[model samples]
Target: MIKRLICAAVFSGTIATNVNAEELRFTVWTGSKAHLDMLNDIANGFKQTHPDVTVRYDTIPFGDYVQKLTLQMAGGNPPDLGWLLENSAPAFVEAGALADVSKTLHATENYNYADFSTSAMGLWTKDDSVYGIPFSTSPFLVYYNKSLYDAAGLETPDQRATDGTWTWEQLKKDAATLRNADAGVWGYETVDGQGYSARVWHNLIPIIRAYGGNAWTDGTCHLDSPEAVKAIKLFHNMIYVDGSAVPPGEQGDFFSGKSALTVTQISRVSKLADANFDWGIAPLPAGPAGNAATVGQAAVVAFAQGKNKEIAAEFLAYMTSAKNVAKMAEFFPPARKSVLEGDAFLSSNPAITPAQMKIVAQGIENGSVLPSHEHFPQIEAKARPEFDALWSKDADIQATMTKLCQGIQPLL
Candidate 1:
């Protein structure tokens, strides 16, 4: 009888262990084969440590990611883990749709909240509490075609890094010198639209900060200042007055080898690598504020509505780990110190060396994130028309910004 009881207890324990080892489902909105392969490798590694646990990965097209994710959440079934951009987190968080991982995230010894870029962490924090682990983050960088600079007899921006001489004024002057109309190449081309508008914002904010204009104060809009007006005027000048940039409508032509320089995110490096021109990346131009800052975007967050909260959190933790993060960093730069300093990340990408990565790291540390206000989308919608008008020289800068801010104020 005693032997039978012991055997029964052991059998039940084994069954419980098997039950605990079930597969977890994960969903991501955007990634490449290399990204998915790295995720699979991380899952395999996780399985090795916890033999009973399995991970299932799913991907959604970037175009329909939000709509599909919303439908899935409404359908009473959601993945164990998923991706969330920082600017888009408030709506879901306000709806009480994300699992609170404050306790789990804080309790982990390897997790250092301070190690993440402030912009990345700000997206997940609400009322002084953190809700997500940032997986990927990037700051805007100024990429120049080295060959163009050499041909123009213009000095490289990188050479000015130590002296802090690479200011916006200098960039504008250099761009003018490099412009070649006969060859159909302009000094620069950057879009001002829904997503690409970020590039404009990234370039503008530093100027605003330099001019001592603040975007917000204690969650309130403070963009209606003289300094802000000056910054906007500078942008208008870039597009219409100085003609440094291709006109808004003809901007696409620039990407087709018609622009001598472009200021965009580091991610564009991969695409530009295949371009017929020789190019190199550099930090953004300095502003009057005595500092250069870039806007960091695209942070990963876990949804509150996920079915397998615990398992999803575990997967998120694994995804942010040094090894896995380093792999992901090959595509999207890592947001943590461990991965940033790890050999895997430091040695993986030959295109961006550790030194170049350090410049990006510094940018994130000193930069800011787009605010997560409920009215942000509304503000963006209203501002677009005004910005377009200003860029086209159809309206005065001050009047346009004033009207733009007024239109967005009611929504806020």
Candidate 2:
């Protein structure tokens, strides 16, 4: 009777352990095989320690990522972990949508949490609580067609950068000279050619910062500041006056060779794989204020409302460990100080040379993430029409920007 009772007890323990096995669902915006393969490898690494867990990544469209994630939470089914854009970090942190991973991050053996740069971590942390970890702090760069520059008989941005003569004024001059109306080529394309509508802030903020202005400072709207007005006027002239930039409702793709120059980042290299023209990436041109090195960032976050918060936080810690981060640097610019300072990051991307990668490293070191506010969505909504107005030749630059501030000030 005693032996039978002991056997029954052992069987029940086995059943309970089997029931403990859990699968975590992760959300991401990338559907790239290389990215997914790396992620799966990381997950497999986690299983080496916690053999009972499984991780699955769900690809969300970039346009609907935040909204759909929110809906899933509201519908009682939230992803255990997910990617969050820098623009959404402030709002998500304020809304209590992300789990606090500080404990897991710090308690992990040899994690070296302090290896992350303070400037790079600013958007993901508040006081002592870490809500997210940035995986990419990609800087905006100037990608110019070498073929176009050679044919136009002009010194390329790289040459200008080497001599410390690259500036917004020089960029304007090059754009004007490169304009070839008969051949249907544009001199410049703004943020994937959706500048006038979708990427309105992205299209203007770098220029605004270069001119020593910002969207806001200390809860005050400064879109109408004289410096900002001057910056907007410069881009307006590029689009309407000189007709050097691709105007609204037009298709001028830089990767497709229809545009001479574009301002973007290294992640777009895959788009240039089969390009017809030779291209080179240079640091962003300096304005009167000097190099701003504006960056767009993204991070990984564990959802506060997830069913498996503890395990998700553990996975987050593993995924962002120094080794894993260095591994991810092949595709994503890492925020880890150790990785960024090492030799691996310089040659991570085979498509780009070490020289061009140096510009990326310097940019991340000196860069600031895109301007963000807790009420960013509201600010973006109110400024859209006013921003749209700036694309016209007859637009009143100062007054239009003033109106933008008026609409955004109440939210700020």
Candidate 3:
């Protein structure tokens, strides 16, 4: 009888342990095989110490990321952890949607929370609460097709950058010269071909900043400023007058060899791993105000409503440690100072040469994160129609910008 009781107690304890086992769901926007493989490798490492834990990654398309994430939360099915863009950080933190991982980070051995720069942590940290940890403080770069440049007997963006002659005006000239209509190739493509719609800010902010203008400041709108208008006109000319940029209703993809140049972050490097043409990355072209490097940032956050918040935060801490951050530097440039300055980071990816990686490092050192506001979603909604009017071949730059400012000023 006593032997039977002991066996029953042991079985009960085993069931209790099984009940405590966790499966964390993580959401990301990337569907790249390389990216998912790297992430899965990292997730597998967590199982070393957390033997009973498993992590599942869910890939949501970039265009639907924010809206779908919100819907998931509203439906009480939020993932335990997810990636959040800089633009979404402010609103998420304000809404208490993200879990505060400060304690977990501080408690983790050798987590080195201080390794992340104050500037890099600005959007993720609010006072003493850290809603998320920035894993990618990536800077905008111009990726050019070296094969096309060679065929055309033109100096590449990399060469021009080295010669200190790579300016916005020069890029426009190169784009026009490289345009190959018969080959179904465009001179340039905006970020992911959604630049005119979902990514309009990503499409225009760098140009505006390079021209010595900003979206807003101190509760004011600057899109209607003289500098901003001049910058917008240059891009408008590239689309309509120069007929260089892949405009709205077009389907040119830089990775598919349909465009000569594209403006995007280094994370897109994964898309070129098996490409047929030679490609290289360069700093954003200099403009009237000189090279105004802009960064697009994203962070890993634990949802406050997660069923297993504590374990999710632990994984977040582990995923962002110096060692893991260095591993991720292959695609998502690190926000951690230790990893950013390490020699290993420069050679993290076999696809990127150390020389090309230097351009990424330089941009991160000099760039500012893309503009973000707590009212960003609302502001974006208000500015959409106004920006839509600017896509026409005969659009009036000054007038459209004025309307955009008028529409978004209240939100600002």
Candidate 4:
């Protein structure tokens, strides 16, 4: 009986030791094997200091990330660390759902917090509290099929960009020429072909900005502004009138050689590793407002409800250090000023030419991030049906813009 009691004590001690060595749960939207491998490598580095802590990265779909994360928070199972999109930053911060990680960042040795650009850190900070660190500051660019341009007997977008002739009006004409229904070739495709619905704002913001408009400013909706309306009309004409761009319910993928052009970030060049056709990237065409580069940003945040909030903050600091930021720049553009302007960033991706990378580097330096609001998810929910109404022919451009503004105004 005495020996049994001693065994019981040993077992209890083992259980307690195991409980002390915790595994941190992290959530990310990417399911790609390559991406996960890189992330796991970074997580492995934590062992240098935290020998017993393990991090598990859970993959959440981009469209449902915020919704599902909120559910986890409600269930008291929130991840220790997660990737937050810019639009959700304000809502998350305002809800007190994210831990204030400024102290951890400030205390980290050799972290170099000031290396992050002032503009890049704007949305993640509120006065004295810092909630997150921006990981991706990717700017939108036009990826064009060089073969299609050659077949269409027209100069490529990069050529036009250099000649100062790459305007939205010129794109409309070029797209019309490149489109061939008989050949099953489309002139343009929006981000992943979900633009009209799941990615409505992502699809239109670049053109809207190029035309000198924004979703809102100072608590007012601007979708109905003259510039915004004009920009939407041009895209409408491409889908319905010119029949160049792939419209709602249709599919045309540029990487598959079925589409001539697409507007996304440089990271997507990974999709062209085995391309059968030639491709090149160029800055988004200029509009009446001149060159208006647009960026989409995501950040690393530690949840306020995490079981190990302090440890999560320490890991966040390590992952966003200049060294790790440069490592991640191969897939996700870094927001660090030192990395963004360095030669390492220029040659980070083997798939892209140095000149093409220059376009990306320039856009990061001179672009505006997509519009973000505290109530963005609510605004998107309300604006859904209104935006759907614009996909049809004979859709009154001015009237639709007014209705869209009306739908999202209350949420604004």
State which candidate has the highest TM-score.
Answer: 3
What is the C-alpha lDDT profile of model 4 across 296-370, one tens digit per residue? Answer: 899999977677888889899989999888888888888999998999888998888888889998888888989
- Window of ten residues with lowest summed lDDT in model 1: 11-20
| The 10-residue segment with the lowest total lDDT in model 2 | 11-20
Per-model root-mean-square deviation over C-alphas: 9.8, 9.1, 8.7, 8.2
Q: Candidate 1 regions off by >4 Å?
A: 1-40, 47-80, 103-120, 126-130, 191-200, 251-256, 341-348, 410-412
User: lDDT tens string, model 1, 1-412?
Assistant: 2122222332332211222237676777645565677778889988886687888777987545655665655544555667776555665555555667766666666766577756556667787665677776766677777888888777888777667788777877777787777777888766322223434455566567766676666655556678888766666676667777676556434345677766666655555545776777677777666665655556455555554567667767766766676777776767787676666765566677777777777776676664556445456556667666666565577777677777767756
lDDT of 4: 0.85
Candidate 2 ranges with C-alpha deviation above 4 Å = 1-21, 47-52
**How many residue pairs clash in all the candidates, one count each?**
5, 0, 0, 0
Q: Is candidate 2 or candidate 3 better by lDDT?
A: 3
TM values, all candidates: 0.79, 0.89, 0.94, 0.92
Model 3 over residues 1-412: C-alpha lDDT tens digits?
A: 2122222332332211212338898999999999999999999999999988999999999987887877666655668899999998887776777789999999999998889889899999988999999989999999999999999999999889989999988999999999999999999899888889988899889999999999999999999999999988998999999999999998989998999999998889989977899999999998899889999999999988777888999999999999899989999999998888889988998999999899999999999898888877778878888899999988888998999899889877
For all candidates in order, the CA lDDT equals 0.64, 0.84, 0.88, 0.85
Q: Write the residue-wise lDDT of candidate 2 on 72-175 in tens digits.
A: 66555667899988877887777667789999999999999888878778888899999999988888899999999999789999899889999988999899
Best by lDDT: 3
Show pairs that collide, candidate 1: 21-52, 97-304, 98-304, 99-304, 210-289
Model 3 Cα shift for residue 176 (angstroms)? 0.5
The true-versus-predicted C-alpha distance at residue 111 of model 3, in Å, is 0.6
